[model samples]
Target chain A: MGDVEETVADVGEFALIRRITGGRPKGAATLLGPGDDAAVLAAPDGRVVACTDVLVEGVHFRFDWSPPTQVGSKAAAVNLADIAAMGATPTGLLVGLACPSTTPASVVDELSAGLAAEAARARVGVVGGDMARSDTFVISVTALGSLDGRAPVTRSGAMPGDVVAVAGKLGWSAAGLAVLGRGFRSPVTVVGAHRVPAPPYAAGPSAALAGATSMIDVSDGLLADLAHIAEASTVAIDLVGGLIPVDQRLIEVASALGADARHWVLTGGEDHALAATFPSASSVPPEFRVIGSVTRGAGVTIDGKAYTGDPGWQHWR
Target chain B: MGDVEETVADVGEFALIRRITGGRPKGAATLLGPGDDAAVLAAPDGRVVACTDVLVEGVHFRFDWSPPTQVGSKAAAVNLADIAAMGATPTGLLVGLACPSTTPASVVDELSAGLAAEAARARVGVVGGDMARSDTFVISVTALGSLDGRAPVTRSGAMPGDVVAVAGKLGWSAAGLAVLGRGFRSPVTVVGAHRVPAPPYAAGPSAALAGATSMIDVSDGLLADLAHIAEASTVAIDLVGGLIPVDQRLIEVASALGADARHWVLTGGEDHALAATFPSASSVPPEFRVIGSVTRGAGVTIDGKAYTGDPGWQHWR
Candidate 1:
């Protein structure tokens, strides 16, 4: 730990911000990017979908555990996932960073690099944001997205008999976390998965095009997130454990560590995977795999039974 | 402090959030407010101007000195003011709050009340937001506004010979802070001004309608904020100090306290006043008063002299 010479308070805020944002490529949709009073993004379809989230150090991520780049990338990725959950293509992002003055300039630059890398990966531009002073490091990001003439697939639109499906891998993130927690450093794949997530960037709008009735990103686990759809739509969701797909690497790791892979698949969070309900007549997108159906019920169930291992991660709890 | 009897950790994150958001009036623009994966706001004008800011306790505010309501109101007010600075009518706001688990529930409730009260004053709805655990209290807000068919008055439009004007009070907030810092609790007016700011909410769009060339909310001090406009537009701003219509009461406070009124007027920040430049021929909005003029040069000056006092408040400084 002493290997780190100085902290955030050492480098200062504005300089760190300058270092972070300097020389980053901004996307075309960002008519005006950062370094202004406010940023302006082109909303070609005339509508913008907005979402915000704040991730705090220690509570959201521990600096000792997560590298600076991972923190920045995850912050942008998670917020963009929310925009995608609304069945809209993300257009731009605004980030608010609060850190001590002594923070390393390199850390701040790496954070910006992570954000730019992730933004380019998602094809969304980072428009604007603010930097402030805080004792503990915190990053608050607000994502703006374009609807592109597509109807927003709200959470209240799911109906009975609608197919429930997911796009992107499940349980890999949580499995990776377990490996890290146990101090298992040798498995590069597991460690890499734990550090950064790859949310299905295209599947959100593709599901919308496939006529998804309701959708949400799986950041808080399959059961908990699906429960949101069920409660909002006033329908029940039944997920078949057999139909649920798992990453083979995650399965091997879980079995090797005497952990239940199904538990991780059902209860692990932070994958940023998208789960949506669609009409039976609609064809599932290539990125999505059908696993269950909506029904007339009050909550979500896994394999005809309530999950007893863990409910999932809750911010308040 | 011990008399407070509880901390953020004692109340927990989710329960406190539910309490904070319960029964507050959400304006019509909100399709869904809180309790969902993401809240939706109506953008009838087809475009949304979005901005975000984060405030941290000890760094941005002091709980012991400022009321919870004041903290809440200030948090929303500043963000809404940014939207207004864009010459857009704010549609909705989302707040992300992070507090220690030991924080009292009443504090959280009061904070919520402040947010609701300020939102009502700004005429913008409070949509959904995120709540999490943190060691210190942090409030992060994202404000969304609708342009209402008008082109946004960016800071880049100031031209030579443009008249610079302001709507709303300045120096009062700084004066108020002085009162708090010195523990001189005499004038209730100054205290109230510091506790909760009264931004010129209507003046932002009014300036746009009046054909103002460029505009910004005075978050930093007058000279410093104008410097931003000057840099962005590549024009010099010459202020007529005598023309700045500061409240005489502030002068009295400064005199009584043996402080410089001009210092407060030039360097005091957090007023949320709208500052803009208009072409000489353009009609000045009744809500704004001309205080300066744009010229061919660089940076901001007062009475043909460089303001050498202080550049204004900066985060992490």
Candidate 2:
């Protein structure tokens, strides 16, 4: 028999919350955690960076493909990525969970464990949360971050002649998704990337400290996100196809699915990689690799040419 | 033709967000509002109060009974009430919306207008939000607040001799719900209270300055919420039935539905009223009225008698 577990209805709301928050360790930023009407978080810099994201079942994840732990981890990662993209250090997280009453208690426990583990990885704390009963599962996370007195690296800061660079791996999440959809036997590393993305959390602040002119997290494909930077900064961005790093596992998965690896590298999203622009290539940190350069124009391009493939992920579409 | 409108799919995600956030007034605490990856809010007191609440379509509200505007207002009110309960001045809100792709663009616009209107009432800004496509509608709001250097009032701070007081009307929401369910033509004041509660946003800080030992927002009935205070503070609370405030409209609606107004007053949830404990009745501010007193024991009693009705709203139940 599998592990025995009770439903949320059996334990009730307050008891379930107690079970979720019982022994969790809080960070210094969390002056007061759960059990209060509202959690108090220390914002020593006098300014707080806040962002929110929601994941709906069937649209964002499938229970058959992603376990509760992965769902929670993905939710936390995406929200944290937004904070990081703003060149802020994440401090606290508030989660709103909606699930069926018949959901197993172990699912909630595992989900909370995953969320706390991810937050701990970034040295942040889960401060407060709300839970309710719904027909399908939904995970909504809001992350609070501190800028530490540094000027926020906005997308509007990039200027022509700035060098474009990236700090983390890309294409793996989309490649992983493709492999899974095609029922291809692939490496666990590639498959896991789709279920739970590992974002470059520290790279955001590092890029800001290194004098990044502009920055954004690669959630929607590289070109799609860069287009936002280009529009906001009012400058064109040109990526060198050979300079952009591609993982070997992603290449293997793409090949197995008979899909173009370059397509995934250019348009695949959900990797949450950090992309930024600097005044010069020399100013780019050791962790970041120069992929392209900014130019005086509009929109993003690859090797001085427009991308003719599907742009990126659109929620409504 | 009743006002032609475009669907979310026609406008797309980015355009829909722009339509919702464009031309909105920002409050003083909003350093950087929507459009960026994240919003920046000032936390001048070095601490920020954070809370979250989720409202599912059928469980929280019905479109047949309440308009989209009322849904938005209710969502903002409940979350803002949590911040007020902490004796903090609310500064900003982050919303996450999930609805079907077929939803009209005007519906989203109306919802945003409702949220912005309610936020403006408290001098707070609707800073940022995330939207996704789902089969059913869901609205999740996270509120951020500042203590402005004042100490936060917690539920565990109640002393044995503390006098219990409340600063807002009660039982109107529950009575209104009963009246609506019974198809009784009740006063709009009673019915509107259920659709969108008017929480006393200012009385929280006033009570804190008057030395309120402990405070809570009456979201889950007076007895249930006070029981939370009693458990947290490890003390017994005796509420005086005669001292509890009952609105005339609430009584009329209760009588029309053949229900007991006293029962509704004792067990009604979602009133968003401020309930607190002070050192003495005289310490309570003019906005607040004395309702009971804390004692040395455990559990909450009404005039020294144990209540035997349903405890309160249990989400899972």
What lDDT score is found at residue A173 in candidate 2? 86
**Which residue segments of model 1 deviate by more than 4 Å?**
A1-15, A18-22, B1-15, B19-22
Q: In CAPRI terms, where does candidate 1 land?
A: medium
Tens-digit lDDT track of model 2 for A100-193: 8899988999888888888888898888888888887888999999999998888899999999999887898888788778775367888799
User: How much lDDT does each candidate structure score?
Assistant: 0.82, 0.88
Model 2 is docked with a DockQ of: 0.87
Clashing residue pairs for model 2: none
Q: Which stretch of 10 consecutive residues in model 1 chain A shows the poorest summed lDDT?
A: A13-22
Best by DockQ: 2
Q: lDDT value for candidate 1?
A: 0.82
lDDT of 2 by residue, B28-125 (tens): 89999888889999999888999999999888887766778887888999999999999998999999988889898888888888888889888988
Q: Provide a comma-separated list of chain B TM-scores, one per candidate.
A: 0.96, 0.97
